[model samples]
Target: MTEGFLSSEEYDEQAHRLYDVGDYDGALEMLKEGLALYPNAVELCVGLGYARLAREEFAWARRAFERAMVLDPAHEDAMVGMGEALLRLGHRIEALRLFHRVEQMGFDDDIELMLTMGRALYRDGLYTQARDVFGRAVAARPDSAEAVASLGYALHRLGDDVGSGRQVRRALRIDPDLHEARIYLGHLLYDRGDWEGSLREFERVPPVEHWDALAVWRILELKRALWHMESGDARLAPWEDRLRALEELDDPIDRLLAEIESEVAEKDGLALDPSQLELFSGRAEGGREHRVRSPDGHVYRGSWSAIVRQMRDAAGFGHEPLSAFMRRMAERWHEQSGVDVPFRDPEVFLRAAVEYRLMFLEDGPD
Candidate 1:
């Protein structure tokens, strides 16, 4: 069929397929073409909004969402898109209000809507809120493996490791193909010192299916420790290649940030603890008065661990254990920048986090 003869719904569907494959540019072009032909098409506007969002163009996303909302005030997807855009734009309260509006408009039982809002909350580090929404999604669709897995993730972030494990296991039972949940379960087991069990989970996921560098790293570490595999072993080649590919896919800005942090650390004689090579860790502390500036320019002052705690509290993560909070931050850094932050050591973690733009070192309070 010719593109010129496609209906608005067909255009929206084509754009959605492109978006799902991470082709935001193509999705944007398709959406723009559709919008030009059918300016009043609410679905096309919502698709445009999501495509813009995937590109990190929050203001444009909001405008697209606003246009969709004006055309159909009760559009659920449009409201969710606007809420996400607002969250990215630092308008948390308004974003939340829009989510609530969706529920108030009688979409509370909508499993997809609930999951969408829950994931937005999860991405913003609002674990408590995400947990609640995911719970609702699970209730609405008891057989939905994705909803159950999402709830599991939220529970994990909230420091409920036992609950998280159970929910994630249940999700896997519902759909064994849920590799993301399986990978998460592996990390959770690794965190609990269950190396054999962790390796079992990691091995179930084929190296080709792994997207996150952390998982590939863990798989390699586990194989080395459990099987006594040498680094040059033929069995390890695919995983090593996968890790390299994942690392290479990191954002250029993040690479620049890592380079800058590396230079600063080298010049200042800061060295990462050799024991801190892995992702998870126990904890550490210091007594010196340390001050750090967050991305928003707010300064947190105290010892190294204390500064992280203060930042955690400010970010509404005080409810979780300090170690868990640090590990969460470190995991996020790895996922974003493909660089590991040493969660066991506060100083090292903070130093590494500068590359992820999570925090920066500042002079001690005078």
Candidate 2:
């Protein structure tokens, strides 16, 4: 029996050697044969789970990991494998729970586990929690630009724009080649209306041609959007030649548009109801009215911003168009109603009035 066990151990060692050499099929074959002789072999089960996971067979990988866990619940690799499989299956919450268990079981020191947990939380929209997890990971390995960038993303999601910017900058300082941090910092600056700053950030992004087509397209689209937004010129002439040069490449313009639309929808508290949208009016036989629905199920007819802009325009409101609107309003309101508009800054009052008027229009004389 001892000799048989030694033979099984030798077979397992050979299987691991095959796995190390990237001979996944041979490794799996050997592991299966070894496991057939020693069904409860924890190492064999873990190796099989890894092989299955590498092949993208997440369900089978999960089963093997589960069997390994049953044999040895303290197996860190098995636990991590199970978490990975669960993550791939979109069971993020379960994966997180398993990861947390791994952490509690003295796996908290593992940078990889922390990263996995942080990423899972980020994907689950728990940005604050993700940031905390990433912070721990960064503390463990301060030199990891990936961890710093991920933490920055989580902070950005949580609306800590300044904090996020700092984190991103720190990541770039650590590793100037960190393209994700550069891109994200650019996005954050763009969100805050710092067009020149955003352009500068984007300029630092590495030109990794053909490696990440979608990311490249996103960068291009962002530049175009920034140019158009800041200049208010829809002609796209400034970027036309460059864009044409990129047309032959994989253009992720549609994806970028979708992301922008979703972001706008979330910010405006409006439902991205496709049923309310009209496209290509110039080519259509007749002009069609697009209906938009809000998150509250209120049907809004027309483009969201256009409708709001028209309402504000009709109300004789001009925030972005006039530099003195806030100052003028504050003076007017102070003289008329004796109510201090509660804004110390001219821009703040201007934006507030625009928002107030928009709300008044929606609510109607209330």
Candidate 2: list runs displaced more than 4 Å. 1-44, 47-56, 87-94, 209-215, 218-366
List, residue by residue over 1-366, the lDDT tens digit for candidate 2: 223454567767988898889798888888888888889889999989988876668899999999999999988888878887887677877887887787788766688778867775664456777888899889888988889888888887787878888989999999998776776676577557777787677666545421222223334556667654443355434343333343333222323434655666568666555733432211132322333333233232223233332222222232222222333445556776665553333223333443544222232332
Following a full C-alpha superposition, what root-mean-square deviation does model 1 have from the true structure?
A: 11.2
Candidate 1 ranges with C-alpha deviation above 4 Å:
1-3, 254-366
Q: What's the residue-level lDDT of 87 in candidate 1?
A: 84
lDDT at position 101, candidate 1: 91
Q: By lDDT, who's the top model here?
A: 1
Q: How far out, in Å, is residue 144 in model 2?
A: 2.1
Q: Model 2, 266: alpha-carbon shift in Å?
A: 45
